[model samples]
Target: MEKTYTVSVFTENSIGMMNRVTIVFTRRHLNIDSITASESEVPGVFRYTIVLRTTRQQVDKVVGQLEKVIDVIKAFVHEENDIVHQEVALYKIRTETLTNGDVEKVIREHHARVLTVDPQFMVIEKTGHVEETQLLFEKLRPYGVLEFARSGRVAVTKPMKELSTYLEEI
Candidate 1:
């Protein structure tokens, strides 16, 4: 059975490394649901978090292939429960919606905060899992959302040991 998997790839900062890492998945015909890259705890190292729906066998193979990339320092595949993750979503809604108390109530109910309120539009921000963000989006839709954007997942493993420790052991 296929399941969602989050692959974390640690690599030395280098040009074109992202392209090479993504090519591995492209070659396998796997579609990446989301991908985010940023500097890791280790100063010179970077981390790539990629989410995809694939079988365990296929994910394992993808991880193995990722490890073969020249700049990849380490790669690990994690089940949803194995890591804690979150995504940020920003919603742009017409400023007029704020005139009605219902919009404020809806925002409060969803636990979203108003980032900015201008004459033209109001910006609201929500940070949570995909479902949470989507729920907020749906609730605000009737109020007229001018724009919506949700970022890729950002995650950290559940293990107590820090990533730096793993890098040292390697």
Candidate 2:
């Protein structure tokens, strides 16, 4: 099974870190689905939320390689027990395929918001479980989806816990 794994990497914020990280996957021929990196709560540190298709063994190998890179303070694969994860998806739908009633029905059923109504498309913003996000995509298929963008899964361990916290105790 092509399972999805979310890796949280804490590294120094500097040049070539992304390149180095990406090269690991490229060299292995593992095409990443999505990646989002940004400053973390800790200064001089960066956090990357990478979504990729692989098995548990492959994920472990990837994390091992990531930890060896310079400036990588820590790297870990987050399972459901280790973190709370969520993804956000924005879908643009064509107006032609949807009547007002139909749109309302989908919106109510999925808890989605119509962000804008330009003459060309209607933008919807939804945040929730990955399955829920996928459901929106399925529902909007008949409506001619114009474009879509999703933020990579962002995760932090449950209260009183964090990746670092878990590691420190080890």
Candidate 3:
């Protein structure tokens, strides 16, 4: 069965490393749902959080292939329960239709905020789980959305458990 897997990979910071990692998934015909790359807590290392849907076998194969890349230090696959994940989204909507109070309610309920406002449009920013972000999107759709963007899932395992340590033991 196919399931969503969030993979965290640590690699040397160098040119083409991201491309190499991305190409592995492309070659396998897997569509990455989302991806975020940033410096890790450790210096000289970069971390990538990638979300994709595939079978357990395919995920294992992909991670194995990723580990073989010269720049890749380690690649680990984490299911939903293994880590805490969050996604951020920015939405631009028509503010003329919704009252400030109504908008404030949505903002307070979802912990969103107005990032920008023009005479005609208001840009709202929100950070939350996938479903929570989607729910906000649905609520704002009625007011007409102008534009939006979402950061891919960023995940970290619970305290006392880290991907690098877990991989090193194996």
In order, candidate lDDTs are 0.95, 0.83, 0.88
Q: Where does model 2 exceed 4 Å of error?
A: 1-3, 96-99, 163-170
Candidate 3, 1-170: lDDT as tens digits: 99999988999899998999999999999999999999997778899999999999999999999999998988989888888989999999987956657766877888898888888988999999988999999888877888878899988976576645755785
**For candidate 3, what's the RMSD?**
2.3
Q: Give the alpha carbon lDDT tens digit for every residue of 1-170 in model 1.
A: 99999999999999999999999999999999999999998889999999999999999999999998898999999999999999999999999887779999988998999999999999999999999999999999999999999999999989898887887898
Checking candidate 3 for backbone clashes, the offending pairs are none
Better of 1 and 3 by lDDT: 1
**Candidate with best TM-score:** 1
**Ten contiguous residues minimizing lDDT sum, candidate 1:** 161-170
What value of lDDT does candidate 3 attain over all alpha carbons? 0.88
Choose 1 or 2, whichever is better by TM-score. 1
Q: Largest lDDT belongs to which candidate?
A: 1
> Whole-model lDDT for model 2 versus the true structure?
0.83
Model 1 earns a TM-score of 0.97
Could you report the Cα RMSD, in angstroms, for every candidate shown?
0.8, 2.8, 2.3
Q: Which ten residues in a row have the lowest lDDT in candidate 3?
A: 158-167
Tens digit of per-residue lDDT, candidate 2, span 41-71: 7768789988887888888999999988988
